[model samples]
Target: MTVRGPNLRLEGSTFGPRKISAWREAVAPFWDVEIRKEDSSEFRGRSDVYHLGNAIIGLTAASELRNERSRSLVARMGVDHVAAQIRLEGHATVEIAGREVPMAPGDISLLDLAQPLSLRSSGYRAMTVIIPRALFPEAGTRLGAAHGTVLRGATPYGMLVNNHLRSLAAHVPHFTPAEARAAGQATAILISGAAGLGVESAAERPLQRAPVFLAIRSHIDAEIASADLSVEQICRRFGVSRSGLYRLFAPLGGVAEYIRRRRLARACRDLVEGGDRAARISEIAYRYGYGSPAGFTTAFRAEFGLSPADVKAGARPDGASAVRRAPTDLPGGGWDDFYEWVLTLDA
Candidate 1:
């Protein structure tokens, strides 16, 4: 028997404008996809998504695609997974540290989902595996060091990972559910091992990472509703220097800003989707770590351009209206499940 959850497929050519709309909805959780104007009217692509227990793997082929993910969106979405991709065919450039680094066929790139990412590619096929950052606690340092860097397929470890990914794409779809789950765990463990392995000395500088960075971020998320979530508390709990912690989160607009953005974003979602329970703005503010309702109101308005009341009162699309993608199944696929999976894939 063959199933598509661990082996689903999407052919964008089958739908009209709805195809593009549905694709946007699927990617909205992470990227702000910008299809070239020329390709917008008639977008074409194919996606084979796999569920690897601890990972969501995607093999995508597209025509002239550019995806822009900003720091603001990063804060709003707060999906901190590690996205590792290998270019199979065609050319793509991923912007890192203000530089557009190109990926040729057979190259690997590691990206941090918490940071900003902008990728542009034309007529390309690549496989991307996204896993939660918390999955590999032991190799946080190595993974941190790997962020924003590309590994040439020519390198020893790079070649191994590249081939391993290709094999996974070829065989994972046929595995039974139990087999897939075990594969997912193996994928995480193997990737963690690879993240720890050093590349040949002359190839690239040794990868380095702040040991406590991911753990601290996790702690913040776990404690966002608490007033005790101060920068000092984080430093003491993680046993890291204050300056080091600051530097680690500088890309996300500082530790305090990260927390505030996360709170407001959570508050925004709650107001928009919290149902009857969200009728009171004060309750929403208090639920998200705000001491003063007035302060929460000020910050909320500044970030979302509307009061919590506005969202709750249905000024913006919410609840049923927010399900803009596809209520009924579309031709060649069912995107509703895909959208939900993107939001709920913890590993």
Candidate 2:
């Protein structure tokens, strides 16, 4: 069945010191949102603030959002939910199903909201479609399996899914009540097909079996920068035996090593794009669990084939270069469709 509604609108300002906290409290019900501001005040701290809205679709970027409050989401325990995102520009990091999924421009990330999840954007703009557990089709099972998974242009399904989202987002404002319903149905069909559910019912995959690895991975990702973060801590938090944790990483090359690789990857990104007044390599390395510069440098060299310094000196790749586009073309569609879409670009 299709559903239709008028385009939504949301507006909040930082007129007073209390504006940030006011916004945070406002957005808490819709999604877990955070804001980190340079200004330190009673109302707006260095934490997240939420702005309430009835699922919006709009675009934002650059000078328009410099003093902006960062937004973050962590879906607490629940049965299951769906988020269809289309990456219009910039990038996003979403923790799901035990992995850190990155979304770049022109990509799509289908997210399951039932499981605990977190999302962060580095000055990103996109379209997101958030739907209740009941509205989703049977294909949600496979879509769950694909959570925390990054789908880029390399996959046909990924391309098609992204294109469909783009189309839906573009027309969200003009859809008639009847057309809106049809749009929802089409979105579900495409998402189901793109997720490889085929003709088999979504029931083929059970909801009770949400990916346990996601919780494990999410914890690890958050602690990656912490020198004290460890697999043992992960084990304790999830109540999984050490051996179970070891097995989880056996396919990738063991837990400790995996964390190292992931951390180094993050450090590489930071160094290259960190710009002026960026943290030093030593600091980056230490932050990512490296004890010494020598150790961190060795790993960085091996993986990226370039010193962190060299990468920082090099310019951002031409294609990945970020430019502020009109809010209309911002990935994931405009704010009107923001909460309903999942962004999975690879930037």
Candidate 3:
């Protein structure tokens, strides 16, 4: 099959007994999956996957599959993504973080990839969205206890989210890169709101810091090119106190560190995938507000353990290089933009 644009479709009947192995390999990048079958020959399964810029959505149907995340597997994989499963047909149950959740048609439940999860399903079909943990900082507290919280599709928010996912799936192929990014942002915002993370409108008078933090973070991202970007400017712009800003960013290692890290990350992406062969390293550095090329190179080396030139060189398949280039075929703005969108969910 000619795979294009991060999309994939797989069927188990094509592989016979090796079907289990095929399934494991297909999802190994995202999850550690296992299955139990009374007779291996009778096993049947199919999966359709769509990569939605920041997240991956898959529609899967299988005959009696079980996923048991072992301690050894968890230690080896270090998985850091979360999967939100929306049941479309049949039934399934998930056990995670000392909580058990059951699902019927039109019901959704969340599973944290970091924790151990045991799922059992029989003749099941579902839509699963796999999202990075960093994309939902506002839902951090709730996500800690999100394992067993089931959202019924009959509710208003549930209906909205479910319908949106269906529509997104139907129209994913037609979306431009920019539209995909916007849809991904909308997905995160809707999930945050559904999880009660204060993603409602500002007119609703949300007193939580999540919304305010999102706004302030959006402002910072927009103004990152400005050399004068500072905590005081952020405070004045957002009407937040210096102390409040510090407290909000304390967990992220302070506001300045966050900005620096974001800048370096963007520079790294540009060096590898910016598609401007003649663009000088110094120009990219200055674009992100670095005072000097030397300073930018030093910081980039410290963060990525390689020089900017090494990173750029790694993208080409020549001789051995200091670093291996990871895949950069993602639509939209990649990880940096995804993080910005996550922080600005309410925006």
Candidate 4:
């Protein structure tokens, strides 16, 4: 649902300089504050606040001055509350519910508004997601495991979630009402998944796990130009055992075959639309991970019944004679429509 809230602002010397003050005022509607120090000198300064979803998800990032403080105060907070904060730039030390938590880039902290908490923020930028506690049955108990948690590249789920957040930050605005609702539900599922709650429905477990696989696939696609884009390399980079990685790809053939097919498909499109007539077949083959041109030609021919040279030569006819290899079109087509297809996949 489209969330509605008051039009609010924060102003005054509470944010240090006039420039920073203006920014603080703009964001004050969503964050309560107690600024400790205001000097240009860098030292521990403290700020106290809680974030609503608007300030948490809508803003790309918020800049804040460092502060040093100690206090525990929260009132009327309920079970249906969760706050997700990720450091976008700069560092912040967060202390929540009596625990010391250090935060850095790609790290996510789940704040429980029901309990007393404090945050020690240095010069920093961050994104936060506040979820209602009522939405999660095991909210309080599970939140302890997620509080002040660090989500870095070290963990597969962490990387996947971070990547999802990055993607969402860029596309959240384009989401329609239905898409937004779905996206919100997906967000809750992801949080639960990360928290080890295993709260997904029977139908959602697969898609919930799809992010990690999707992350790997996207990584492979971007690195196809590299000669060492092998399944082994992917396993090593993502910390998945060879067997485990294979299991993740079993539905789409084997990992090695999947990479080959993807590369060949991309090469097909490039050969047809890239307008590089003089592009050497051997060069194109090697560029797409084929060590030998002959092997590439064989695979290419097998995939589309046309050799690389024939395809590049435009020997494939344009109409009914030639196969117009493409996926099924949606009722309403484009990216959002394509996402419908994506959502339908077991992934």
Please name the candidate that would achieve the greatest TM-score relative to the true structure.
1
Model 2 lDDT, residue 130, Cα: 54
Better of 3 and 4 by lDDT: 3
What local lDDT does model 2 show for residue 215? 59
lDDT of 3: 0.61
Q: List, residue by residue over 233-333, the lDDT tens digit for candidate 4.
A: 99989988888777666544557766776677667656765555447889889888787999999988876678878877775411101222222321122
Error of 1 at 139 (Å): 5.4
Predicted candidate 1 versus true structure: per-residue lDDT over 31-137, tens digit per residue: 77888666776677778887655677899987778887776678877766777789999988887556667788988777777777688897899999887666765
| Worst 10 contiguous positions by lDDT, candidate 4 | 69-78
lDDT of each: 0.70, 0.50, 0.61, 0.51
Top-lDDT candidate index:
1
Any runs in candidate 1 off by more than 4 Å, and if so which?
1-9, 14-18, 137-139, 197-209, 239-241, 289-298, 305-307, 313-334, 337-340
What lDDT would candidate 4 get against the real structure?
0.51
The estimated TM-scores of all candidates read 0.81, 0.45, 0.55, 0.43
Order the candidate numbers by TM-score, best to worst. 1, 3, 2, 4
Output the TM-score of candidate 4: 0.43
lDDT of 4 at 221: 71
Better of 2 and 3 by lDDT: 3
Candidate 3 per-residue lDDT over residues 143-252, each given as its tens digit: 53344456777877778888987887777777776676677677766665666633211021221365565556557667777777888889888888988887665534
The candidate 1 region of ten consecutive residues with least summed lDDT is: 199-208
Question: Which should have the higher TM-score, number 1 or number 3?
Answer: 1
Measured over all alpha carbons after superposition, the RMSD of each candidate to the real structure, in angstroms, is: 4.6, 16.0, 10.4, 22.8
> What's the CA error at residue 166 for candidate 2, in Å?
1.6
